[model samples]
Target: MGAAYEGLSEKTRTRRFLASVLHLTETMLDHLVDDVDGVDHVALALVGVGDDRVGVPTAIAR
Candidate 1:
């Protein structure tokens, strides 16, 4: 999430977050992660596929 957040453009981040969010603290990330309860909510991480079968997450959805 740190990587993804850093990758977000300033405009994109502001529009998505509805504010001028410079960055998310580790505590904030933890809260975001913990907010998902399997029964009610979930997050999906999208990644590129490669022949080596290793990839970095490109996007995530909640």
Candidate 2:
């Protein structure tokens, strides 16, 4: 997830958060991955399948 976030273009990141999000704080990461009940909030990731990029999200849906 961190790797994926780091890969986001500045324009994409800004569009996502409605601001310039340079990096994820631990709390933000926890919230993104852990908080928000699935009943109301959901996130889906499309990740790279293998090699050094394994598990890195290529795209995401929320």
Candidate 3:
């Protein structure tokens, strides 16, 4: 998820996070991960196939 967030375009990041720069600080990531309810709310989609997969999330809702 962190990788996916980092891969977002500047425009998309700004729109989604309402910030010119989206910084996923360790503290922020920790908070997100610690939120059990938030875990349930998140959704992600990755590209590529199987064990060789490598990609960013195409969509997210949280």
lDDT (CA) for every model shown?
A: 0.86, 0.85, 0.69
Q: Which 10-residue span in candidate 1 carries the lowest summed lDDT?
A: 31-40
Regions of candidate 1 where Cα sits further than 4 Å from its true position: 1-9, 22-31
Give the C-alpha lDDT of model 3. Answer: 0.69
Specify the highest-lDDT model's number: 1
Q: Higher lDDT: candidate 1 or 2?
A: 1
All candidates: TM-score: 0.53, 0.58, 0.47
| Ranking of all candidate structures by their TM-score, best first | 2, 1, 3
Let me know the TM-score candidate 1 reaches against the reference structure.
0.53
lDDT winner, 1 or 3? 1
Residue 37 error, candidate 1, Å: 1.0
Put down candidate 2 lDDT per residue, 1-62, tens digits, no spaces.
Answer: 88799899999999999999999989999988787677788887788888765587699777
Model 3 ranges off by over 4 Å: 37-62
Clashing pairs in 1: none
Instruction: Report the candidate with higher TM-score, 2 versus 3.
Output: 2
Question: 42, model 3: CA deviation in Å?
Answer: 11
- In the range 1-62, model 3's lDDT, one tens digit per residue, is 78888899999889976778677888878766654454555545455445766564465445
TM-score-better candidate, 1 vs 3: 1
lDDT tens digits, residues 1-62, model 1? 88898799999989878898988999988868888887687888999978999997899888
